[model samples]
Target: MNTQTLKKPDINILKGQTITGKWHKKKYYVVKELGSGAIGTVYLCVYQNVQVALKMSKQSHSITSEVNVLKAFKKVQGHSLGPSLIDVDDYISANGHVYSFYVMEYISGDDLPNFINRNGQEWLFTLLIGFAKDLQTLHDEGYVFGDLKTDNLIVSRKPARLRWVDVGGTTLQGRAIKEYTEFYDRAYWQMGSRKADPGYDLFALAMVILRIYYPNGFSRGDNPRKTLQQKVQLAIRSQSLKQLVGKMLNGDIDKADQVKDYLLQYVMKQNQQTQLRQKRLSQKNQQETSFHPTLEVVSILSISGLCYIYMTLFL
Candidate 1:
């Protein structure tokens, strides 16, 4: 065998290494790699005895843009729509190359598909409503989530919360979208441009709904738009929701507020119907239980009287 030395990994933070915040000087221990994409890799870490997610980018420019977008989101932190930014810093790799990274709130939850699997699909209406409201908040803040998708969304239980991750695609309104998944992109549907608009995000949201409703058929190697339209028409019987989905596909994403309101109404109506159903069921059960004992007593008394009279007559 030829004598050669193994080289260390380049520009990437390895697991178990300690990363210190440049400003606060707080140290975080890397647990494991959460994910890796074109721009960067995310790691689960422990900071101040609390778990947090840290994103390290290969290119300094990419991390810089993402950090700025996250900073903007911080200005409107009251909404709690996206993960809270913790800190930003630079790390020197084994090869002496400087890499940029940022820390953010670690969301402990399942993605959309897994969440539906665990919670049942009945909660979809409420989940979508919450997501739409978050998007509305981002829109109100003059930003658009360019890369909205199932993977980027995390849903929590108990209270049923929704949160967005991956700020690299965030863009200011009226500019071209910085990034997007092809299936969720309006340009792929031949419906609109790649401009960063509220409608663009809405179109992606529509795709998200379609994916949730028809997990297997949404991307079955056919014309996605046509297939989606046909499936929605055949499967979804609710006229109001169908109309909302149609508007989203048609690039009318500015109507997110309307969709949100409609979903809210639907959820409220469902709750009322559920309560009514439960009440009726309880009453029916109560009535049956009350009637059966009286009937049993009357039958026993009649049988006893008949038996006594028959014995007297025979004797």
Candidate 2:
């Protein structure tokens, strides 16, 4: 095969291509394309028995922007709420297109956005609680998801999974952002004009939760709730993302500490219960194996008598 025969891909090769459904890598067969974005395209791929979602850059250097961010997330402190990147690969396509690919656990289920679209306001708080639990755990581990957008967040039912997809090219190490920027307007994004801080991250999450609660005036006015149905509707739509967030940062909603306290209490009670159960089981096992002299002697004598009776009858 003459490698030179392939046409060089520039603006023309990928011109009509949808970001979501092209195969640059064949080591794993791409089942189908799922979604697309400005930076990369996502494909549902299969590797043996495992089903995974793989993403590759449409642009050469931009892929590194996301890859670098994902690498940082890997170092994040606690239980990351999303799928860990299993592999990152780079190769040339048939059109002489150079690409870098990222493989991640294809989270099975609908996203939180879709859920919000289908469900009611009642689910938002419950979902946010789980999300906060997972996110704070990640921050405590000294890492941020970079961009905390709803598109980057995947949700499941019963057992909630905030599948953290990687950085949306949003990376700041606790001291980079300074003041307001256009990007910081989103409920989960912070535009720091001075420096990046974990506090900003909390503010972002609060913004996201509040948007779920109040969509209309999350930025300036009230969330536009005239009726119960409208109020419920507001709870589901993801709005002005930027303005709602700005409003939230300026507002007086305090959720971080409260959720933290609740988590501590819940974790402690669970540990105590686990320990008590283990201790009781250990005691029971010890008693079962314990040597009781009276019972042991009776058991020996009964066995000897039975053996003698059998021998005498045989004789």
The candidate maximizing TM-score is 1
The local distance difference test score of each candidate is 0.82, 0.55
Q: lDDT of model 2 at residue 303?
A: 99
**Per-residue lDDT for 1-315 in model 2, tens only?**
544223434322232232232454336666777777766677788766688877776565566666666666667645554666777777565655666677777877666656765785445555655766766665555554445555556675457655556455354556443223222343323223334445555555644455445433333224322232243344534443333333335443333444555545555675698999999999998887675666898899999999999999998
lDDT minimum window of 10 residues, candidate 2: 11-20
| lDDT tens readout by residue for model 1, 29-113 | 9999999887888999999789999998767778999989988988985778688898988876556656678999998788887
Q: Kindly report which residue pairs in candidate 1 clash with one another.
A: none
Best-matching candidate per lDDT: 1
